[model samples]
Target chain A: MSAERYNRQIILKGFGEEAQQQLLRAKVLVIGAGGLGCPALQYLAAAGIGHIGLVDDDTISLSNLHRQILFTTADIGKLKVEVAAKRLQEMNTQIGIIRHPIRLQKNNILDILSRYDYILDGTDNFESRYLINDACALLNKPLIFAAVSGFEGQLAVFNTPDHLTPSTNYRDLFPIPPDKGEVANCAENGVLGVLPGILGTMAAAETIKLIAKIGQPLTNKILSYNLLTQEQYTIKISHGGGYTLPKTVDEFLNMDYQDTSEGPQGYAEIDASELVKLQQLESTILIDVRERHEVPILDKQIFTQVPMSEFGAFMSKEFYQKHVVLICQHGIRSVAAAEAMQEKYGDAKKIYSLKGGIVKWRDHFLKP
Target chain B: MKIELISFGKISEFINNQNIEVDGIADTDTFKQYLENQFPALKSMKYKLALNKNIVQENTEITNNAIIAIMPPFSGG
Candidate 1:
C-alpha cells in the first residue's frame, strides 16, 4: 500500500494506520457496474480497498453514459465488468480487481459471494436485490444495499452477522416483490443523473465504516433522500414476520426471486426473420394488435389491423384456417392476445407472436 | 385533527397532490383506508408510511398537525 495515495483519509482522527490496514485486507464484491456501482467502485478503489470484485453482464450503451461514469463513449458495446475492472485497476494498482462478466444467478451466487467479506448490491431491480439479501443472510455476510430512482434514493446495511440481536433484511421491509411493471425503473421513468452518484457514495461510506469501524453504520435502518428538495432522513426498519431465509444451497437455488412473464403457456414465438420465412406460405396471416394510431405502421397489405381493444369483436365474426401471427408495440400484449385466441380457437389454428414486436422488426429488417 | 400527507417516488403519481391535508383522521389505519378509497391505484403499490419522520409499523394514533410520509420502494440504481 502506498502511504501517499491514502494519506488524506489516514489523517482522520481515529482512522489511521490500523483502519487503513483493515481496508487493505478487506474483500468486497459489487454486483453491478452501472449507475451506483460505478461511483462506489471508484471511491472504494481510491480509498485503497485491497480486494474488489465487479459483476455485470451488460455492455456499455449510449444511454448508460449519463449515470455510469466509469465508461466513456468510446467504450460503448464493451462488457461493463471488463471496462469497470480496467478503470479501477488503473486507479489503484495495489488492489485486486476480479471481473465476473456474468449475471448473478442462483447457481453461482454462493460460489462468488463466499469468496468476499462483504457484498454491495448495485443491481437495478428487486429480483437481484432479494437474491443477494437471501444469499448474504444464509452466508452470514454483511450486505450494503442501495437504490436510486428519479430524484430519490434508499440505502441500508443488512445481515451484519450480529446474531445476539435481531437484524432486518430486504424481505422484512418488502415481504414480496412488486408485480411486473408496478414499480417503474430509471429506464421507464427518468432519473436525475447525479442521484445515483450521491447515493452510491453513501453506500461506499457505509461499507468503509463497517470495514474500518469508523462510525455508526446504517444497519437495521434505511436512509431515504430526495435530491429534488434536498431532504434526507433515516427511519428504523424492523422485521415484520418470523420469516426464514433459505438455509441450504439447494433451497436457494429453488427460490424464484424474479417474476416470470405470465404470458400464455405453450405459445410459439417467431422472430422477424422466421415470420418472413412463414410469410412466403399462402396460408400465413399477420394480425397487428397495436392501436391503429401507432406509428411505424406495416406497409404490407396482408397484415390485418385488429387492435387489442377490438380483438374480441374480430374473434367473434372471423374464422380463419391460416397460420396467425400477433404483433403489438412490444411482445407482451401480443402474447396475451395469442393466449386469448388460443382459448377461443383451440388447436384449429396455429398461432404465434412476433418475439419482439414491430420495433425489433424495424431494427432487424427495415432499418437502412 | 388535521394531518399533512406527503408521498414520494411512484406513489406520488397515484395521489393527486404531493401534499394532502386530511381532516378527521385519528389513526394511520383509517388514513390508509381513506387513501385507498380516494386513490384506488395506490392499493397495488408497495410502500411504507412514516409519521412525523418516524417509521411506524403498527397503526399509531395521528395527532394534530402531524406529517405522514408515504414512501414507495425504489428499485433503480
Candidate 2:
C-alpha cells in the first residue's frame, strides 16, 4: 500500500509526513464492542492506525445488529472480540489486531492497558467507566472519552497536554458521577439510531487531532449534540478545586460514585454464618423476606413467609421476638428489610442478614 | 441590586428571549435564587455557576456588577 491514502491529510502543513508516520506507529485500545466501539474501530482501522486492541466480554446479541455495524446477522451469539478482530483483520491485516475476550476488571486493566498509547472508551456501565478513567489517570495516557444516551452524546479528551495546552481530565468536568438511575441507558428510554454514529465519528476525529496535533481539540470544553434536531452546544470546563494527580490507580478507583443510585434504599443485615449456629442454640427466628417467586428456592421449615413489599405495613416488630435472621434472593431487598427492623427494634432484637442470600448459604454453609 | 444572569446549553435556550427582571435581588445569592424561581428545572440540575469567568459554587457572595453564567453538563456527543 502506498502513502497515497493519507497523502492528502499529510500534505496539510501542520500534520505533514511526521504525523502520518506517528499514526502508522501508534497503538490504540478500545473498550466496549457495542455501538460506539464499532464505529470508532472502523474509522481507526480505515485510517491505517498501527495496532488496535479490542477488549470486550459480550457476545453479539441479535438486538445489537441495529448499531454495532461490524457484525453480521449470522454473527449473533458469537464472541464479540473474536469476530470483530476477524472482520477488522479482513478489512486491513496490515493493522495488527489483538482481541482480548475478558471483561475489563481492576485486577487486569493495568497490565493489559499499559501496552497501548491511546485509549477510547465505549463502555456503557459506570463500573467500567470508572476503571477506564482510573487506569488512564494513573498511567498518564491520553484518553478520548465518549458517552451516549437517548438523543445525546458527549466527547472530550482527558490528560492530553501538548506544547500550548494545559492538562485537563474527566474530573475537571464532572467531579463525580450523577446519582445512579439519574441517567438511564438507551435500552430503557430509547435512543435515535444515528446518535452513536455521530458521537463515535467525532471521537475518531478527536483521536486524529490528538495524534496529528493539527486541529483544536476539545480539551477543557465538552461538545454536546442533540441529533434529533441537529443542534450542537458546548460548555467550558475548568479544573475543580480539589483536583490533584492521583497517587495510584487505586486512589482514583476508590473515588466513590457520586450518589447515582436513584432507587429506594432497602437495607438488610448479613451476618456471619456462625451467628445462625449460635442462634440455633438460642432458638433464633428466621424470616424469608423475599417474594415467593424468586430463584433458588429453599426447603427449610425455619423460614417465615413475608414478601418484601408486604413485609412492611403488615408485620410488626412483634413478629421478630429476639435475634432474627433475614434472607432473600441475591441478598439485596432482604438485607434492606433487616436494617429497617434493626432501626425500629434497636438492641432489643438482633437482626442479621445472610450474606449472598440463600444461595450462598446453601453452597457454603449447608453443603452435605 | 442589578446583575446579569446568563445560562448556557438547554437552560440557556429556555431563558434566552425574555427580558425579565427578578425582585428581591438583595445579593448574588438572590440571583441564583431568581434563576431557580424562573425555571423550576434549574433546581434539579447541578450547574457550574460562573461570575464573569470566575467559578462559584452555591452560597457565593454576589457582587452588584457580576455577570453570572449558569452552565450545565452537556452529555451529548
Candidate 3:
C-alpha cells in the first residue's frame, strides 16, 4: 500500500496506519449501483477498501444522472456495474474492484454475499431489501443498509451485535414487506438528488467505522434523516418478533422472496392479448379501476365501472368471478387494486393487472 | 399527558410533526391504538415506535412530555 495516498486519513487521530491497513484488508460487497450505491462505492473505493465487489444488473439511463454520480452523460445506456467499476478503479488504482453485473436473486445472493466479510445494501426495492436482510442474517455477515425516498433517508447496520444488545435485522423493524405498489419508491415518489448522496456517504462512514473498529457503528440502530427539515434522529432497534426468518440454507432457498407482494402468489401482471384470452372465459370479470372522469372510457357492457375512489366500498361487495382482471390508465392503480383483491381473496380467485393499461393497448379497447 | 410526536418518511403523511396531547392513552399499545384510530391510514402502514429515542420492543408506558418518533421502512436508493 502507498503510504502517501492515504496520508490524510492515516494522519488523523484514532485512525492511523493500522486502521488504514484494516480497510485494505476488508472485503465489502455493495449491492445496487444507483443513487445510494454510487456515492457509497465512490467513497469506499477512494478509501481503499482492499477488495470491493459491486452487484447491479441495471443499465444507466438519462434519468439516473442527477444522483448516480459515477456515470457520465456519454456513459448512458451502459451497464451500471461496468461503468461504476471503471470509474471507481480510476479513482483508486490500488483497490481491486470486482464487478458482478447481475441482479441478485434467491439462488445467486447467498453465494455472492457469503464471499464478502461485509455487505452494503443500497438496492431500491422492498424485494431486494428483504432478500439481502434475510440472506445476511443467515450468512452471519454484517450489513450496512441505506435507503432514501423523497426528502427522507434511512441508514442502519444489521446483523452486527453491539455491546449489551444482541443484533437486529431489517425484519425487526418491518416484519413483512409492503405490497408492491402500496408504498412508493424513489421512481414513483421522486427524491432530492442530494438526499441519497448524504445517506450513501454516511453508509460508507458507518462501514468504515465498523471495519476500522473505531467509532460506534450503527449496529442494531436506525438513523432517519429528513432533507426538507434538515433534522435527523437515531433510534435503537430492539429484537422484534412476529416475523419468520429462514434459519437454514434450505429454508432460505425455499422462502418466496421474489413473489412477496405480487406475482404468482398475489396477482399476475398480464398483457392486452392475455386479457382478451381471459375475456372469453365466462368466469373472468374485467374491472376498470380508473377514476370515473378519466380516459376514453371502456365499453360499459364489458367493464364494470369500479372507480378507485370508491374501491373500498367495491371491495366489500361479493363478486362471483373466478378470474378478476383490473385495468387503468397507466396500469399503476390496477396493480394496487389487484393487490387488494389478492389480499381479499387469496388463492380463491385469480387476480391480474393489465401490464401497460388501456392507454398502451388503445387500439384494442377503441375497436368497434 | 403531552408528547412530542416526530414522524419520519411515510409515517409523517399520517401524523403531522407536532406536539400531541393524549388523555386516555397510558402505554405504547394504547397510544398506538389511539393514533391508528385517529389516523385510519396508519393502520395499513408498517412502522416502528420509539419513545425518547429508544425503540419500544413491546407495549411500554408513555411518560408525560416524552418525545415519541414514528419511523417507517424506506425502500429507495
lDDT for A124 in candidate 1 is 80
True contacts kept of each: 0.70, 0.17, 0.86
Q: Which runs in model 2 stand beyond 4 Å of their true positions?
A: A4-15, A162-165, A185-188, A242-245, A249-368, B1-30, B37-45, B49-77
Tens-digit lDDT track for model 3 on A1-368?
Answer: 99999999999999999999999999999999889999999999999899999998767766689999998989865789999998899899999999999878899999999889999999877888999999999999999999987799999999999887898999999999886445753124677788899999999999999999999899888999888888889998899888999999999999888732243225777777789999999999999999889879888999999999999998898989999999998677887788788778888998889866776677889998
The runs of at least 3 residues in candidate 3 whose Cα sits more than 4 Å from the true structure, single-residue gaps closed, are: A185-188, A259-368
Clashing pairs in 1: none
In terms of docking quality, model 3 is medium
DockQ for each numbered candidate? 0.56, 0.26, 0.69
The per-residue C-alpha lDDT of model 3 at residue A118 equals 96
Q: Candidate 1 chain B: minimum summed lDDT over ten consecutive residues — where?
A: B12-21
State the lDDT at A331 in candidate 2: 60
Residue A313 lDDT, candidate 2, scale 0-100: 68
Stretches off by above 4 angstroms in model 1 are: A161-165, A185-187, A242-244, A259-368, B16-24
The candidate maximizing DockQ is: 3
Second chain only: TM-score per model? 0.85, 0.71, 0.93
Interface RMSD of each: 1.4, 4.2, 0.9
- Kindly indicate the candidate among 1 and 3 with the higher TM-score: 3
Of candidates 3 and 1, the better by DockQ: 3
Relative to the true structure, candidate 1 reaches a TM of 0.76
How are the candidates ranked when ordered by DockQ, highest leading? 3, 1, 2
Q: Across residues A1-368, which tens digit of lDDT does each residue of candidate 1 receive?
A: 78889899889888998999999999999999989999999999999999999998777766689999999989976788998999999999999999998878788899999999999999887778888899998898999999987788999999873434377788777767676546762124577778999999999999999999877898888888889789877877766653568989888888986532222233466767678887888888888898889877775586788999999999988755568889876566787798787667766777788865765556754554
